[model samples]
Target: MRRPQATPARVIVFGAGATGARVVRMLAESPEVGRVEVRDPDTARLRRTVDSCDDSVTAARGLEMPPDADMVVIATPTGTQAAAARAAVNAGASAVTTSSEISETRELLALGSLAAENGVALVVGAGFMPGLTCLLARAGAAEFDLVDEIHVAKAGTGGPACARQHHRALSSLAIDWRDGSWTRRSGGSGRELCWFPDPVAGRDCYRGALSDALLLVPAFEGVERVTARLAATRRDRLTAPLPMMRRPHPEGGVGAVRVELRGRRAARRHVAVLGAQARPAQGAAIVAAATALHLIGRADVSGAGGLASIRDTGRLLRAVADRGLRPCRFEGFTLSRDETPRP
Candidate 1:
């Protein structure tokens, strides 16, 4: 008797814009992915994405998830993510979403019981900042005895949709987790100087209506303080309240995410900082692709949650690094014994 070969995975991606197209290309390259289909309402954009990929990939104009799809990766606009995710679960396919919008993330999380009942996994915020930043926080938290505060900051946007979201994030109200309570503040009010990895170094960041805290809080138990910020320019802040004046570039340039973990270790204070740099679209694609693969390949993963819900952070981070989004750690700082506080 001859041994049987395992079947390859079938993945459907919704949206063929910058991040979606890149996701399709990356999924097509994986040997585990047998068939890749990309769907977009825009025919021109769909055709361009399919034309750019290899022969194994196909294009469709419909947004519905096919029943045969093993996994559905959604890179559509933030507003449409919830509906698409529900469709994916209804079709009995695992789903991954790259949405960073707080409201959208909450909507997706609300589908947890539905997804769990159907035995499908729904991974939310599987993009650059919330995605990778979530992973970094989880990994860094493991190094400390007690994690007290987690601050995440990101610099840059990916495609036009991302740019628009970045603008809107600044204009919306910001949410922060402080001392066992949630507080709302003006998006651009809390200005802080943040240092990202090189190439995207030292940019002024401000509190934003980002989804990091919402996703991270549930994953880490008893963490006191959690805050998220986005890099912004003086012009960016001034123009945030108004509609975009001009068309955004087809794709933005280099982007980065910095995760800082503060806690105690062996009766002493310890801090760990990790960061990664890549084009926003590229980084998001890498993280999303890795997440889809992991979700599809594993039988143990189920339920709907953010990247912080991932059971194996090391495995996912290693896969992401393998795909070229290697995370870098910052070192060379010593804690002073008398630096606790001054009365």
Candidate 2:
């Protein structure tokens, strides 16, 4: 759970789907939360998930809501971050998001301003993958006094629905952040990165397919190079459906994340973080809900306004534990010709 601000907070999460519910469960069980409110366009789904919780949260549709909610977790797709951030701050609350690197939503740039104006925070890209990966980068950059390079890799089992959503539409442009500018890498232009030190699997690199490295590299500073590689369960030439636009309830599956940081150090080393939810409908709800409460409780979230990162979420796992959810495990080490652990 996030550490509490001076006053008890009430949180609202948009899009009451799988991940949203997880974030909610985390919030309801949190001591930091005074009242839990959930809002979604889908009233039926909202009612159903609310019933499962311990009578802590009041569920409502988008149009009707409580006087004020302290924080909002935008569990919507990648494209909706800007609108979601606006809605939450407008409603007198801070915001959190799962759209790791939502590029299409340029309106997010104004969140800092809105948050400043409202005296409430509007944070984005706080999901497990980018959020957690960024945390590792921060930890690494801090661990090593002088840093020159940074690299990140993630692999996981995606739901059939999310995969299909990827197929729903192809991202018109593949981009990343560089020196405060957006640079487009050719769509499907990246090469296969050999992943060697997965926490679950000791050392095996799979064929890591496409990603938005071009846009993200610039946003990350003090690094000579930064690469974020992704591995999904099935890699067809076909792209997965866009989760930002919509979320289709897919069949069951699991997913994991593995990241590495290489800089001025003697050798290229790997570090990993993993997250997975089984039983699509229920699991997704849990992820979303869990995310919401986690952010509202963070001390890092200044005056209830600003962007929050996954790296700032170790405390949230405590609430995950309260719900009997297991936090992702961390394991792995630098590789040397003779240092690889023997099976």
TM-score of each: 0.95, 0.70
Instruction: Give all candidate RMSDs, comma-separated.
Output: 3.0, 6.4
What's model 1's lDDT at 150?
94
- Candidate that would win on TM-score: 1
Alpha-carbon lDDT of model 2: 0.50
lDDT (Cα, tens digit) per residue for candidate 2, span 148-218: 44455444423433444334323334444344454555433354543423243432222222232422353
Model 2 deviation from the true structure expressed as Cα RMSD, one decimal place: 6.4
For each of the candidates, give the backbone clash count. Answer: 0, 50
- Give the CA lDDT, 0 to 100, for residue 175 in model 1: 95
Best by lDDT: 1
